[model samples]
Target: MTEQGTVLMTYATARLSDADIEALGSELDRIRADVVASRGERDASYIHTVIKVQRGLEVGGRTLLLGSLLPPLWLAGTAMLSAAKILENMEIGHNVLHGQWDWMRDPEIHSTTWEWDLVTPAAAWKHTHNDLHHTWTNVVGRDRDIGYTIIRMSEDQAWRPWHLAQPAYNLLLAAVFEWGIALFDLELDDVVHGRKSKRELFDQVRAVLGKAIRQAAKDYVLFPLLSGPSAVPTLVANLTANVVRNVWAHTIIFCGHFPDGVEQFTVAEVDGETRGGWYLRQLLGSANIDGSRLLHVLSGNLSHQIEHHLFPDLPSNRYAEIAPQVRALCGRFALPYTTGPLYHQAASAWKRVFRMAFPSHPRPSHPRPSHPRREAAAVAPYAMA
Candidate 1:
């Protein structure tokens, strides 16, 4: 079973009993405890090494771009810059901001201290992503990442005429995902609906603008200008590199969340939820990408989305180490472990984008009752398209 439409509570009811769920949760807790206890120098070294490599790539890429007038240099420089951006945004920035390395007592790498190389401020992202999105996971209305409130990602989401253009715009979103994420972190709908104040919205917008301008000046102005005669080519190379990073980040993220067999939930399903229930939801709701160590590193180890979702603050390097235990736990529980290769997973997520653009009835076997809270939460002020 690659794709599913049922909410998590109903899915769980049909599979595991409450006692079984509790047992599963206990097992998961043990796994987490083991990892937390074993975290040491090896894990610390992995993150530091990644950071060093990323900085080297960025420096080398910019140096090469200074001679971007040469075709080979332009290609090589652009590739290196793209890789560096991906590493910063994914492996280092994302995990560090998740407080993955805070146990090291390294103030420089602390979540509260590190600012990412994106248009969104670290604080804003932590609120929306680390707080809201992670807490809510795949809950239909509560999680804003479901189609990012622009494209239709779940059957529970009401389809609109605008979604007809999702297949096209989703492509644009992937190319400029950093900007899309910056806007998404603003929670514009909350401001419109009075859930968030205009003052708060204004403050966030100001922060975003500040970050955007700095990022623009650094990439579009300062670096390009430093190249003098190669300024135009350097500018283009930087732009190309950013686009490449954005697209790769978008693809890896979508693969982790939207691929086949990944489940979604209604708010009702999660009501009075237990820790085990949350674990089950995370396990069922997330999909994984089957890839190599290099692929995992480039993805910030998010290829093990299930593990990351279950242990968001765990070091990225450990997800691979613990993946087998997680998979085995799933096997023991007879729960589905959804995973696929990059191409297949990416295609599956995109297939959902196109397929869910049009209206369709819910599956007859699991008829969904009205969820007023879920419905209201899903409603936004306006469609982007």
Candidate 2:
């Protein structure tokens, strides 16, 4: 193995003191307050409308798919179902369940009771994802999402022989990303290492099993059988739709956090962090995807992953509205605002996966970019986190 903690780091050129950090926090809070104050009928209408459309699409697709006797019908049905599942899983379910709309205080949209399309129960996932993953976005060790309990996502995670199969592991995980996330929610390593009690682990298992069984029966069994002789077609179409949703979710998510320029941090980096420090960490650690309005909606507006990380509790729809402001803030701060199209981000993430499969060394530093006003900020890995 190579020496640890030797990576070259970069930071914004605008030199910041503790007072400046607090001022940044204050400015962010102002933006947040504005968004929160603006929340009302429009935000509520957006989510409800999205949910309605998603449900309608799922039903229409299932109906057509159930009776499909030709390839064309099957294809059309599969497309609709795929779109529905994507909307449900990404735009509607994920954001609503984030309690992003919970400020309205409606029972149905409340975070505590919202269940998602994935195999993992919403409660279990929220505990691990919202509470844990968001709490520690790109920290090498503390964030289990760094590699989703499997791949080696950062240099700090020592390369292991098993990681050699990551390309295969990653592909399989993409195919069944929902199941992979469910299993990760259980933190299997904790069970094997005795960090979790047998009773607690089994309880989680039972909850997951219940959700899995329901999901399987709905798409694979009940829906198929309900179609009688057309059961075969419906089953296949449903399976295709689910796979499409899984792969899409996996790709979008991986692109957001694992792309080339996104920084990874150590726990020490965030020790006793203040509000501005936390905001800076989120800005540095997260990446974004450039895309059209439709792409943004279909990706659950997580295409604005940088804004999402910076304001996770804010309504996801608002990410788009506030992205320009956020970008402006990044420019003013001279901080790196990592973003690119979806394909480039995906390629970058995959490249990292392959490169990090084996042991690697710290990246060689080059001279900071030339700037007239000040240093052209080269993003440092953990220097400012």
Candidate 3:
């Protein structure tokens, strides 16, 4: 049977007793309280100030070039920097708005109608992200992230065209349109999962198209005319920055579940399992990443993806503190727990993608043996889902 099918079959049969569910709930509650207590001081005020300062600097930098104090090449460079800043605002700041930084306040209230301009609708991050991706991770019929058009997660998705040409196509796609693909997922998921009425789906498509057009006009026409020819260079720079930011986001997200050790499940498997077992699968089938304290702070410590899945509402900052307890719990359950350095985990995920896309391609069959100055490990048994 295919891996996804196998996972579904296993999930269908697995059962958790009431005591197990209660224990899982108790553990989650304890972790939530600890996270809130420890990271409660994350004032959104300071974060807002930083964003404003960055925007002001970008504007002033553009104005300087327009006034002829700075060269055109300098203007172009500055514009690119500004664009990067915008991408950062979307990726990093958006997570903060999700209360990945602070859970005391409702993110929706702060994100949709806050005085502080801290949200990005471009990524459609919340809908495809917080709602779908996290909630239905690795479930082929449900997890929007796994529906790679050119890449298959398991043998079930294997097809002649994909087997023949997907590797090269997927690599280029990942480099250029990872963000675009993620955006596409929002609509595709609704169709695939039958989440929308026919009329609602059509309306959503029209709404998205209109939003895209308006954004393009604002970025390409209005901004250039207002800022002068310098805005052209700025636009290019911004585009490059956006690519970098998205690539980072894609890499970070992929590592959580795409590494060799992680398992992929089908709808049947997940449906068969109890809530506690499903939660355990999410934890065991995911990997953790480790880096500097500041890195964890910036990326929402999503390297600790299992913990995040298990305790979605908890502040990310608390992942480090709960790491030991989580490890102990998994050990007690005899469940596998995987972790590694950031690059190590990322490389593993990337390699897995390559393997899935190009079956004949030869790469390291295992995690890199060489220990870099900083290396991450991926922990998993050699069992298929």
TM-scores, in order shown?
Answer: 0.92, 0.90, 0.71
Tens-digit lDDT track for model 3 on 129-207? Answer: 6777776777765675773544665544544545555656555655555346535644764676686777866665665
Residue pairs with backbone overlap in model 1: 2-260, 2-261
Output the number of the TM-score-best candidate.
1
Which has the higher TM-score value, candidate number 1 or candidate number 2? 1
lDDT of 1: 0.88
What digit string (tens of lDDT, one per residue) describes model 1 on residues 1-385? 2125433335743376666777788888888899899999998999899999999999999999999999999999999999999999999999999999999999998898999888889999999899888889989899999989998888788889999999999999999999999999999999888899999888889999999999999999999999999999999999999999999999999998899888888777776566677788889989999999999999999999999999999999999989999999988988899999999999999999999999876543443333323233432311212
Where is model 2 more than 4 Å wrong at Cα?
1-15, 362-385
**lDDT score of model 2?**
0.83
Q: Which prediction has more favorable lDDT, 2 or 3?
A: 2
Which candidate number would show the highest lDDT if scored against the true structure? 1
- Backbone clashes, candidate 3: 9
RMSD in Å for all candidates? 6.7, 7.3, 9.9
Instruction: Give candidate 2's error at residue 129 in angstroms.
Output: 0.6
- Summing lDDT over every window of 10 consecutive residues in candidate 1, give the lowest-scoring window: 376-385
Error of 1 at 215 (Å): 0.1
